[model samples]
Target chain A: MKIVKYEDIVLKVKLACLQMTTDLPQDVQNKLEMMAMQEDGQLAKQMLDIIIENANIARQENRPMCQDTGMVVCFVKMGQNIQIEGGLLADAINEGVSLGYEEGYLRKSVVNNPIDRINTLDNTPAIIHYDIVEDDVLIIEVAAKGFGSENMSQLKMFPPAAGIAGMKEFVKQVVIDAGPNPCPPIIVGIGLGGDFEKAALLAKKAAIRNLDEVNPNEKLLALEKELEVEINNLGIGPQGFGGKTTTLKVNIEMFATHIAGLPVAVNINCHAARHIKVVL
Target chain B: MATIKLETPLTIDKIKDLHSGDQVLLSGIIYTGRDAAHKRFIEVLEKNEDLPFDVQGQVIYYVGPTPTKPNQAFGSGGPTTSYRMDAYTPPLINKGLIGMIGKGKRNDEVKAALKGHAVYFAAVGGAAALMGKCVIKAEVIAYEDLQAEAVRRLEVKDLPLIVVNDIKGNDLYVEGPQSYLKEHK
Candidate 1:
């Protein structure tokens, strides 16, 4: 059995939090650069330039790229043969988030309660999803998801009759309704053919998926590409100032669903796209 | 379009001259507030109490900045989504708040409130690190308990912005995209 120390997990989570918030991942950076070069509007091009420059400044100075450091979301693949020493895995991850937010000078965006609306101060109680696997290695993927885009996400349950055409229209309409709020040029993550909550979670996963990575499912891959084109054609552009580049990419994740219902979730992510992965 | 340099305490004439899609370099003092602070602002107004600061001819930046690091006036600071504050905005606008710096489209009421008196500017939303550098100074003026949501008086220099909604009721969010689509077609 592989043993992972609790403190070690904490340290790694902390570092992941700090690094992800400061550095724009290479794939996202590359995509933004490509979009900037191809963008038709002068203002859109300028906005992309500023966003690229902001990424650079944040990295060079080891500071957060955006003021909203975001609520921490962690996806963990736990090995069946692995044992965590010292504390619960969730606790360790939360500890790491608290430390990282405090040490990195990131914003404490979490409120203790939705109704009470008091700041949590340490950015704790990270949203964690766990999957048990057969290997001896533990993998943790951390994403600092900003709310500007999170608030723009939408989920809809359609009758089976709606089919692919209806799904495409709904996704397109979500982007149109979102307009500049999600901070275009944006990445769209789509979850299809799942139950309500699962679809939403899948959409969240899709949003943080590596930009350069292609979808393995052939049909979904084609759908992603087609949606990317359709959304970009909408003229939402960079910062919604209008241009040729509204969306940088569209990623779709699909799963089997019930015979009666077709559920779709669209999670929009801003250009910042902060996430990191660590294997232990 | 040539970039216009605007100073704070904006005049009606200056606001009227501005148009949607104009790039602007705004300097001078502006107050920062977001959801929580705006809520409090409305509550204070409802109680007939004075605001933490005067609203007349002033600009409020909708932002919740990260914690400031050592030797820095502010941390990465960018505009939050402006629509969340829409409910509280027209009231503030009526109270002589002449300008707002934020991201995204404001509601029709905000657009109407802006006519003849105010303007709405969109800062590049996620460009917080770049935006924070423009803030030369920052001081929490009220609602310190709100932490990042606290109202801060900030002295900024050449803070880059685009006029999204102008006093003449022009909305760049609508016009900018429409123009781009036309050109591409």
Candidate 2:
């Protein structure tokens, strides 16, 4: 069995969280450049330019691209053949998060509760999702999810009769209603076929796909294109200032589900889609 | 569009002429407050107590900034979503506050109140890093226990912001799109 020290995991988690906050991934950068070329609206194009420049400035200066900085969300995959040599695995991850938020000078946005509402000084208790795989390596993927776009996400379970066309309409309506609020030239992540909650989970997960990458499933890819076209048709261009480039891309992830359930979830990721992956 | 610079404790006629699309560089003291602070402020208003700061002709920025580092004035400061303040806005507008700065659309109730009170402004949403640079001074004026949610008075200079909403009921989100929307065939 492969043995991994707890200290190593803790350090890696902390590094990953800090990296996710202050850095914009290279893949997202390349896609934004490409989209900037294809964008037709003068204002939308300018907005994209400013966003790209803002990202560059943030990176060069070691500053956060946006103020929200977001809540820490980690996706961990543990290998079945490996054993953690130190304290609990979860505690290690939490320690990394605490160190990263404090040392990185990233914003502490986590509130104690939804109602009484108190800010948790150090961003902690990261939202973690785990899966055990056959290999020995531990993989951690974290995204600092901001409040603007996260607040716009929605999930709906439709009757079987509603089908794909219904989904297209729902997504279109959601985009129209969302208008320029979620920050246009946004990425739409759709989760189909899973049960209600699972669909939402998958939808959020689907956002990790590179903005320019196409889904492997041909049918799903076509849906992505169709939805992109329909959403841009809303004329809600960049910064909601209007133009033909309302959405940068539409990504759909699907799974098999019960015969009677037609569950779908739509998670919107703003232009600043920040995430990072590490293997230890 | 005219660009104007004003220190705080200004009067209504000064802001009344400003419309959506005009640019403004504001100097002087503006209070920072977001969702939770708005709720609390309205509660104080409901009790008919003196507000933590003078509200007459003052501007409230809908923001919750990152904590300031040692000796730093403020961390990255940017606007939060405006709709979250929708429920409490009309009353604040009814009081003498003349301008509100935030990102995103306002409800019709808030829009009407803006027209009635001659108050509205907006800033780009994700421009926090750049925005923070413009804040020259910041200190917690009230609700220190609220931490980031506290009402801190800030001094800003040449802070760039586009007017998304105006006292005239003009809106950039609606007009900006209508002016630029193309027919898809």
TM-score of chain B of each: 0.99, 0.92
lDDT of 2 by residue, B47-115 (tens): 998789878889899888876767667787778888999999888878888888887888999998888
Q: For each candidate, what TM-score against the reference?
A: 0.99, 0.94
Each candidate's DockQ: 0.94, 0.62
Q: Per-prediction fnat values?
A: 0.93, 0.55
lDDT of 1 at A157: 99
lDDT of 2 at A34: 82
TM-score of chain B for predicted candidate 1:
0.99
Off by over 4 Å in 2: B1-10, B182-185
